[model samples]
Target: MTRIAACQLAPVPDGLAANAELTADAVREALAQGADVVILPQLVTTGGVLEDAEQARAVAVASGHGVFAAWAAACTARQGSVVVGGFCEAGDDGQLYNSAAVVDATGLRAVYRCAHLWDRERVVFAAGSAPPPVVDTAHGRIGVLVNYDLRFPEWTRTAALAGADLLAVPVAWPAAQPGEGGGPDGQLVAAATARLERVAVACADRSGPGWTAGSCIVSASGQLLAAAGPGRSAAWADVDPEASRDKLVAGSSDLWLDRRPELYDRLTAPRSTSG
Candidate 1:
């Protein structure tokens, strides 16, 4: 079993210094509390929403090295723990991408660029071209996702098919939206996905003016193992990736082995509006 910590952070807009300090502090606290891995919210270095694209682009950091190196060093000194968190990334082509980096005592291991953008994010940040990578760690084989990516089932399935045991999601979900005004919280979506993929999920959501602070950890059976509310909060869970190997929901109903991929060809075909 891996001890997981989901940290709910409130990042100040454009305040990289304050945000970084808070994130580092949270990691230390979680480790002290016996957590083997810690997950933080998306765009944590620069808050969720941005006023100006140029200013947002300025706060983007490299995938690894620098601040990440410092975090790795701290982890190494503390007997080695895994840290997964999101940040604004300065891409090579002079654009910005919402990126999540994985670090441990061995230093930076993997980075997942957010492939899906929501609302005004499309105007400010470029959608990543690469898919989320399943990375190996001391705790387990971890996959990663950003805020809007959770709405896509295909993406999560891709991660599961890639042999990921845990999915680390960093999100900045709004408090309320236009259509579905009142219903289950954002974490429910995560819970359902965890059940469908049969993998543990750790979601770290932000808490601020326009965001929801529902941070949670779900078990492979789609159970809500731990959760937290607004402000700076942390949720803990003990997960075993091996539990997801049992794909049988009932007698002869295997999850992966019973797939009908031949009939789902239309899912990948181009759509037409005139139909």
Candidate 2:
């Protein structure tokens, strides 16, 4: 009976106060709507794809300064509620990472950094070492993947293999151009891709002119259970971990069950230039 909400709302650029308010509002709404876990999009506190110079290097608050802290405290106050959201993590070594924190009413649960940095992000954020997948509270083995992380199937595959029942993605996906008209693929591709592993993939993507419009949830066999409206809304859905597991156990796919790593190694063998 764990219902997670993937919020799709407009978070103003560099507007921490506004973002915090928005996050609190969403958390409240999710709880009111009977959500056990409420997942927010990446950079929920600080707007992503920073454009302004001053905004580009915005420092991360110490689990106390801004929205991240505010959200954490709010979640803790909610008793049974938990929150998973992203923000820039300021490390003790003085490095800022593109990171996400899994929090509950008690405070921080797990902090995951983005291992794969996309386009402009590499220039501003330091990467984190990819850690072995771990379950958060045993309700289900949870794993985190930032936006660009979804492009690589192995990332999701490894998590599934490592016992992740729910693969959560937080993204600030971009809206297709004025006329290009290819609606967001976060869900379409994730669901299609997850069909390979037969795992549930849930994503909280941003909306409006700054980010992609669609936020969605995919079933264990890649079925679209729910989708957010175009731009600024929450996508609500119920994910039965048991059902996801059941589908994987019953479904047939070459994803992990029929892997032939040995053959792949030879197939992808590098060729020598010295012929």
- Tens digits of lDDT, candidate 2, 1-275: 45778888777777777788988888877877777777788877776566532455574645545565566667654566777787766677677677777776666777788888888888777887876244565346567777787877767776777767778888777765322324566667778766876777878888777566577777776788888857547777777676556533435753455677677665446876894
Quote each prediction's TM-score. 0.92, 0.84
User: What C-alpha root-mean-square deviation, in Å, does candidate 2 show against the real structure?
Assistant: 3.7
- Steric clash count of candidate 2: 3
Name the TM-score of candidate 1.
0.92
Error of 1 at 249 (Å): 2.4
Give the clashing pairs for model 2: 75-105, 76-105, 173-212
Score candidate 2 by TM-score against the native: 0.84
User: Which run of 10 residues does model 1 get worst, by summed lDDT?
Assistant: 177-186
Misplaced by over 4 Å in model 1 are 77-80, 177-184
lDDT of 1 at 255: 90
- Candidate 2 lDDT score at position 21: 92
How many steric clashes does model 1 contain? 0
Question: What's the lDDT of the predicted structure labeled candidate 2?
Answer: 0.71
